[model samples]
Target chain A: MTSTIVTAAILAIGDELLSGRTKDKNIGHLADVLLLSGIDLKEVRIVADEQDAIVEALNALRKRYTYVFTSGGIGPTHDDITADAVSAAFGLTCEHDAEAMRLLAEMYKRREMEFTEARQRMARMPKGARHIANPVSTAPGFIVDNVYVMAGVPQVFQAMVDNILPELQKGSHLLTRSLPCPYGEGDIGTLLGAIQKAHPETSIGSYPKYDGQRFSTELVVRARDEAKLDAAANAISDMIRGLDAARAGSNPGPEA
Target chain B: MTSTIVTAAILAIGDELLSGRTKDKNIGHLADVLLLSGIDLKEVRIVADEQDAIVEALNALRKRYTYVFTSGGIGPTHDDITADAVSAAFGLTCEHDAEAMRLLAEMYKRREMEFTEARQRMARMPKGARHIANPVSTAPGFIVDNVYVMAGVPQVFQAMVDNILPELQKGSHLLTRSLPCPYGEGDIGTLLGAIQKAHPETSIGSYPKYDGQRFSTELVVRARDEAKLDAAANAISDMIRGLDAARAGSNPGPEA
Candidate 1:
């Protein structure tokens, strides 16, 4: 409910995602969660699990956004290098967290598995990071500065996010109203642009959807101000009505 | 075929996507298409519908990758500023192309609709750009320099990619083989890392999958050299067999 403009960026770290082997389920889910929580998702970058690439993208996003949420590259495998990259981005020492190690060790004991050296890799985090709980898996995700390093697995990432969202700062809710226009963008683009100019506070967008045979446009009006969003929606509705009436009147006659 | 290392990046532009109202389907589709076509997808960026942001991301990607493929923001609406932003990215003038105008006009004429100023907006392209045909809709996407501007609609974006991909330089085919390890990443990470170090020519990735109960890992080895790929795959297969044997022997009693 605060008018604060809290923004976020998602940095997906995995070669599998870039290879088309794994379609990213985390970005859209995070985007939806952030938007509903009143945080604006500004940019999303999908980089391979290369440390340099992860560090570069992470540094860039973390510097600009209120929060930089990263997924992948935090497992036990050698390819899991996100924590190291995030540490490098912040110029901090990455070492095993005593608490994380204890939690993971306890989880392994419960599962009747050895706490192998490789599994202990999951306990490593940047210095001074608060662990985000993973309800599904025992290994925890960590938040260092504004960067929240998360697992690539969809279920774990979602679970970690559910834990993280309640702790972050919320912004003004971005209100939106969608009106379906029977006509396509061609019929309403110019008028829509004018409405946008008239209501400068609103961000008006026309998205075209095709249903096999013909095209239709959906007019979405978004604004932080509810009054401005409503005004823009009304203008678009009026424009659509005018177009429909004109088309109806000309149905029986030839072009002028 | 050719062993040229062609790399590409995808720039998905839309506010709806960032807002989470629209789930993105183009990035992964493009990634799959690019990988199968022998072009390596190096990066994927999802940006909002701002012209400055588009230009910044487009320039950054186009300069680094062999090709930068963009989707969204090419429709007739005001929010469709990708064409102009791309033109700015390459420092070229955006104007109506004669051939594009003819094609769009003909499409409108055939549909018995007026070729309004809004619809005519679809014909504009950067100077010295070549049109990429959209089979779904007559309005063509365009390519300027190494940047391919495409539609946002999944059907149209895919059709445009079909037309543009064959014309680009194909890289060496990236061959891969997947071996499912019954053990999770914690069980095989150390050995997998050793295997990767032994075969520097191949890239090994261990992805963990959970089916609600237990976690299993999928080890994928990728290499351009077939012999090297097979050699690494065999090493991973041997490692998995060793782990399976050790587990089977231990199941009869307590840990050794």
Candidate 2:
């Protein structure tokens, strides 16, 4: 059975994220979740709340990727302008979505709170949009076309993602194996390239680290095929062992 | 005297970042540091360790911003294709620089380590590029045109930034004032929008938070002029206070 290749892009819109006032916890969290679902998150853009920037990035990402997920700029604040941007990107008029308005109004009434005009702004979305139910704050995020507008708040973002993920079509699972090698990238860079070339089905990456005292590398192998991934990983492990043995056998003096 | 405005963009490169194997710490850290230096960080792009992807992103960002800072994919590993991408972006030939080769050889010699061919790959850079010395590791990062290609390791990245920042031309500082409100964005979003319009010189943003028990908001005012920033901040403070008073004054029943 062949699996569908689903791809996604993230548009993290906020002035605070750009200004570094708020460190983005959403990008990493979503990246992890999307990968587990076999959806490849190809790229991510962090832009300010400017309508033009948001619209420009949104349109560019939406047309290319299977899905474009946006976080932040969906709050009740003046800076929360994702809805307007989404509408402008698709040339649709933004208005108060009827179902969203009704749901929010009922929520406010249940809490003994006034559904003020500002609160109504939370219900504003592009025409023909559907709501992504917000069980936390009651103001729902909206889905216009393939763009899933989500709240920037970490808790709300996670909840909305949890609510919406299962509805999407599935892709083949992406499996990975991590092997820690007691060697630097320099020790295995050449061989790793050869291994990657040999196992065309698997993707291999080498990451080097220096910890004050010594250097080490983490080699990660990824593939859709379980056998290919395992074989590549085993090859990498053997390569590291061979290199260690060779180094131990040779004791050449430093050529100053 | 008017201040010169400098803009910057960050291109964080790596597959591990996209796969969620490594959570990005460099983007936030660099954004924070760049803002304090009077540089307006406009956009950030996180892309996988692919050549065409890196080249496209680098070219796009380098042309638009005053400076484009790139992190990751600069290691000696086979997957570290950033240097090649950098070369391709500007059509420069990638080769081992004499200075970088000398530096790495000396460093390895001093440590009684072999400067193997694989280790020499660290010296590969675009022709005519200058080295950004790595204090933590012996391998050097390079600068080509306005793009600063730095190491992915957080410690090395920070050290390179610290070393490079002071030499660049300075711009007028961006100042900010933050005011906390004991209300949600819905309570003050409209009024905050009005305040933003009134203070055209300052950028005002309202961020709402839900702590599971209560709601609160943080209003931030930013401007190059300290006086303008504080003025906008005071206006927001007064508006929040007025909103609080109005809430306490009215005892409206829930309209079911």
The whole-model lDDT of each prediction reads: 0.90, 0.88
Residues A107-190, candidate 1, lDDT per residue (tens digit)?
999989999888999999999899999889889999988999899999899999999988899998988899989998988888
Per-residue lDDT of model 2, residues B1-256, tens digit only: 5979998999999988888888888998888888788899999999998898899889888998899999998887778889899999999999999998999999989989788777888899999998898888878999998999999989889999998997766668888888888988877878888889899999988877889876788888989888888888888878876776677677754641
Task: Name the top DockQ candidate.
Answer: 1
* TM-score for each predicted model, relative to the true structure: 0.96, 0.95
In candidate 2 chain B, what residue range of length 10 has the lowest lDDT sum?
A: B247-256
Once fitted onto the true fold, the runs of candidate 2 whose alpha carbons sit more than 4 angstroms away are: A250-256, B250-256
User: TM-score (chain A) of candidate 2?
Assistant: 0.94
DockQ of each: 0.80, 0.70
Please give the range of 10 consecutive residues that has the lowest summed lDDT in model 1 chain A.
Answer: A247-256
Model 1 residue runs over 4 Å out of place are: A251-256, B250-256
Per-residue lDDT tens digits for candidate 2, residues A41-136, read 999999999999899889889998999999998887778889999999999999998998899889888989878888889999999998898888
lDDT value, residue B110 of candidate 2: 96
Error of 2 at B49 (Å): 0.5
- Using lDDT as the measure, the top candidate is 1
